[model samples]
Target: MSTAFCFGIRFPMFICMSSFAIIPTSIVVERAIALWKRNKYEHYGCRLGFAISIICIVVSLIMSAWSMGKMNLSDLTVYCSATTNETADRITIICFTYCGIDVITLSGMAWLRTSNVAAMKGKYSDLRSSYQLRENASVIRVLLPLVVFDGLSHLVFSLGGGVFLLFRVHFSYVAYRTI
Candidate 1:
């Protein structure tokens, strides 16, 4: 296929995929921040969340542009394949970055939940504070599994890619090779 055709297809695909991966994490982080700063977040949460989403989109666009620039389009053959070492490196970096962010956010949420529970023990009225704590706990309980799953999936994929790259094994060959 022509280089233009390949670029046209791949560039948008990259942007969409990157945005999909990043936007959720950004929203989850925003929620965690809201949990931490309830007062300010209550007033400005919508704008703040919008800003974070915009930042994520912009970052993904920049990354996609940089990655597309690094591609050796001149070498296109029968099909457009982003199997270069640079592509592999970029994927690994992106996956690991996602994993790292997930870990930090998860830890922060856990800490916030614990500290708030401890602080509210005797300092505040059990009725109101307990209800708030229960709400926070429920949010945490829902978020914890989703974040852990996302992080673990990214971690596993990145590690697998790293191992394959280290061993100089191509994924297509491994996955599609004849027995």
Candidate 2:
């Protein structure tokens, strides 16, 4: 029961970080590309941010899928009731894989932040340096928040998933010991 509860709370975080995060990243990247082509230097920061966000989103999704598939819910149920030891062990292995996925997701998001910062300093010779601020205003205000939100969400989800897994393992261990 506790294991199920933990999963219920944490699973949504995984979904939000993996799937929902992609939307804003895509929108920002598309918008940024348009601005860059138009010689909009000011908005370059936003475009750069979007590009970073896209990279993060892609990595996060890939990691999430890998982790979730390895979890194999059917095997996991064994922890709560009688089942083949082989099946339960398989689920445990899957849980370990999910842990790796969380790490990959976090690392990718960190990279996105670093790359976005670099983009801020990137050169775009086609546009006058003077227009940097002017072009950047809209991008900064809109895309920055979106990127931050996605990144934060991913981090939160990763942590939450870990906590849920830990709790599940603890309870399962106690259950097995008592029985």
Q: By lDDT, who's the top model here?
A: 1
Best by TM-score: 1
Per-residue lDDT tens digits of candidate 1, residues 1-179? 76656777878887875665566577566655655664445567478867997899898888777656766666554556444544656654654555565566556656766765665464545454455556666776787677667656655664565455555554465452221
Model 1 misplaced stretches (Cα beyond 4 Å): 119-135, 169-179
Q: Output the lDDT of residue 150, model 2.
A: 60
Could you estimate the TM-score for every candidate?
Answer: 0.70, 0.39
With candidate 2 superimposed using the best TM-score fit, by how many Å does residue 152's alpha carbon deviate from the native?
A: 2.9
lDDT by residue for model 2 (1-179), tens:
35454355555566554555455545455544444444554456665666667676776556454444434343344244311233344334444444445445444444544544455576656444425433445555665665666656655664554454445546666664343
* Cα deviation of 117, candidate 1, in Å: 3.6
RMSD of 2: 8.4
TM-score for predicted model 1 compared with the true structure: 0.70
Check candidate 2 and list the clashing pairs: 42-132, 42-135, 42-136, 43-135, 43-136
List per-prediction Cα lDDT, in the order shown.
0.62, 0.49
